[model samples]
Target: EDKVVQSPLSLVVHEGDTVTLNCSYEVTNFRSLLWYKQEKKAPTFLFMLTSSGIEKKSGRLSSILDKKELSSILNITATQTGDSAIYLCASNSGTYKYIFGTGTRLKVLA
Candidate 1:
């Protein structure tokens, strides 16, 4: 069975703090690892990493895939109060279906 797990289900951090979120998966034929950030409306696409070790970055957010370990991590640096959101991780198997994690809720206080 294909499945994904995200760590630290919830977190509280002060503004300017750096946070690392983890996601691990087990799939039949792994294709890619995906990251998303969800606020009030819809989830926004963060990154899709097919190659391991190479980090993807946008603004204060970055993510990396570890194919050998079947895992990935999302890092947020200099977090701001507006950075508070639910972060989601998904593993896409070659079968074209994605196994999503329950997500990690992050709260950033000023």
Candidate 2:
């Protein structure tokens, strides 16, 4: 069975603080690792990593995957209160199915 694990299940930080979140997985026939941020409602797509050593960035968020280690990291720099959300990591392998991590709850205080 495929499994995704996220570190630091929760986090609390002040505005302007930087944080690093992690996701690791173990699965058969791994295809890709995806990152999403859930604020209030739906989970918004952040990044999809298929190749190692490539970093995907958007504004203050960035993520990178390490295929050799079967893990990925999400970095948020100078976080604002708006950045507070539940960060989720999922691994896709099977037919249109995904194995998701428990998620990391991040709270950024102003």
Candidate 3:
């Protein structure tokens, strides 16, 4: 079965701190890796990584994928309390279906 794993399952940091979240996967006929941030009920799309050596950034959040290592990383810089959320990583292949990883829960304290 294709699998995705994320490290440091949970984190707690002060309002101005930075955090790095990690994800690694193994899939057959690989397609892409996607990142999402879940704050309440729904998860918002963060990044879609299809090519290596390319970094995708939005505001204080950034992510990159490394196909050779079958891994990806998400970095959040100067995080605010509003940044607290569960970060999810998913992989897709063949049919637009997604295999998700166990999420990383982040708590940014004021």
Candidate 4:
């Protein structure tokens, strides 16, 4: 069965701190790795890593994929209170369906 798992289901960090979120998965015919940030309602897409060595970054957030290791990492540098949100990782099996990991809730305090 295809599945994704994330460690440290929740985290608490102060402003200006950096955090790393880990996601490991096992899937069939893996196509891509997707990252999302969820504060309220549905999650918002952050990054999609398909090719290795090429990372996707936005502001203080960045992510990279390791196809061989079957894992992905999300890094947040100098986080702010606004960065407090749930970080989710999902794997696509070259199909319309995706396997989602148990997101990590990040709390960034001022």
Give the best candidate by lDDT.
2
TM-score of each: 0.96, 0.97, 0.97, 0.96
Q: What is the C-alpha lDDT of each candidate?
A: 0.94, 0.96, 0.94, 0.93
Residue-pair clashes per prediction, in order, are 0, 0, 0, 0
Give per-residue CA lDDT, model 3, range 1-110, as digits (tens). 88999988999999889899999999998899999999888999999999998999999999999999999999999999999999999999868778899999999999
Candidate 4, residue 108: how far the Cα is off, in Å: 0.5
Point out where model 4 deviates above 4 Å. Answer: none
lDDT of 4: 0.93
Better of 1 and 2 by lDDT: 2
Query: Residue 75 CA error for candidate 1 (Å)?
Result: 0.4
Indicate the residue-level lDDT of 72 in model 2: 99
Candidate 1: count the clashes.
0
- List of clashing residue pairs for candidate 4: none
lDDT of 3: 0.94
Candidate 1 is scored at a TM of 0.96
